[model samples]
Target: MKLRKINKQVWLTEVELDGYNVRGAVICGDKKVVVLDTLSHPRDMETLSTLIQGRALIIVYTHADWDHIWGTGGLIWEDARIIAHTACLERFNTDVPVTLHEKQLVEPARWNGVQLVPPNETFQDEFCLDLGSLTLRFYHLPGHTQDSIVVFLEQYGILFMGDTVETPFPCLEKQSPLFRWITRLQRWESDPGVKTVIPAHGDMGGRKIIQRNIAYLQDLSAGKDPGVFEPMTQFYRETHGANLGFALNASKSDAFKLDASKKNNP
Candidate 1:
């Protein structure tokens, strides 16, 4: 794990686990230390605990994906409140075990100490945490997953977009509403307070990253191939294809419903 300071109060920790480069953030506020998505393993979070010692701790899970939440078990602060979207709690309870089982099969030793920990506090739509020096705002952005959220540090204008936006291309949930994702992107674009955007799996950038994701989603909706805009890694190529497939399938489903409606009305 490598820790890089984003600012005096904020830090980014990068970890390579199971072939994926995942990042989590730490925001040291006046009254509380906020730990963003925990990395893949319990051992990864041990150093994090040491760094934020002696302050009130709040663990925020951006989503319930195994990579982000697995380290919840490893946190040293037992009394810390775990926060997430209500949908994230549902996903953690229903889908996380299957994901854990599949990943453990690949590397049992690394996951040996992992314990499933669900959020103790849950909310829908939006929530805010006043950390004395800065406020952390959680916005539910559901395109990546039903429970995916983006964290905005109001004072610093930094946004931690958990897999909601990515470099090259953004992945889509099978049932994600493209329009809703586009609307969120548009809102971000117009928000003058946003200075930086941090994605879970890609390099951090400014508002341009939000524009790029919006363009990709718009292209997918328009039936225009988005591969021409950027070169994708093998993994991202597969991801883009799957996203495109989901969009096409959704379009067809909508068309079919329209046709059925017309026939019934006539």
Candidate 2:
């Protein structure tokens, strides 16, 4: 685990999970310290707890994916408030526990200490948190998952875009609202305020990253192969294949729902 500084207020921590880099972030504020995502396990949070001692702690789960929300134990001291989207909290009763059980069966020791912690606060559309020096504006962005969201810190011009946009491409699933996701990304792209873009997975950069992801999703919707001449690591190559399957599944689901709606209305 390594902690790198993004700015004076923000620090990023990352860990290697199956040849891929998964990241989390910490923002130190005058009134509170906000943890973006908890990474994979309790131990991943170990390296960051000391830097944010004493102040009121607030943990935000970008979503309930296993890689993003399993480390709450490391920073749960003073009645810390865990926050997420309403759909994110709903996932706790569903996929969250099932994912933990499946992983524990494979690596009992590695995941032995992990405990699932659901968010204490949730929002339907938008929410905001004030950190004294800066404020975090949260909006539900449902491209990656229904529970997925993006946080904008206006003071620093940083947008914490969970898994909604990733490098190379964003992953799609049957539940992924493909078109809705692209539209939301477009809104951020046109905004002059979004200077720094922080994603939970892959390389971090400016607004160009958002533009590239938008282009990939558009090509994907057209059924064009997103093949690049440059060499890709084995992990991304495999992920790209999986993404294709998921996109196809989502498209079918959308069509089926549309047909059902038309039949009922007619």
- The TM-scores of all predictions, comma-separated, are 0.92, 0.93
Give Cα-based local distance difference scores for all models: 0.83, 0.84
lDDT of 1 by residue, 232-255 (tens): 567776787788888878667774
Model 1 residue-pair collision total: 0
- lDDT by residue (1-266, candidate 2, tens digit) is 78999789999889888878888889999869999899898888987768787788899999889999988876664498889999999999999999999999999998989988899999998998989888999998887788999999998999999899988678776666566677788899999999999889988999999999988877766567677525677877887888788766655676535533443232
TM-score of 2: 0.93
Root-mean-square deviation of every model: 4.3, 3.4
Give, for candidate 2, the lowest lDDT window spanning 10 residues. Answer: 257-266
Q: Which parts of model 1 have CA positions greater than 4 angstroms off?
A: 228-231, 254-266
Number of the top candidate by lDDT? Answer: 2
Local error of candidate 2 at residue 71 (angstroms)? 1.1
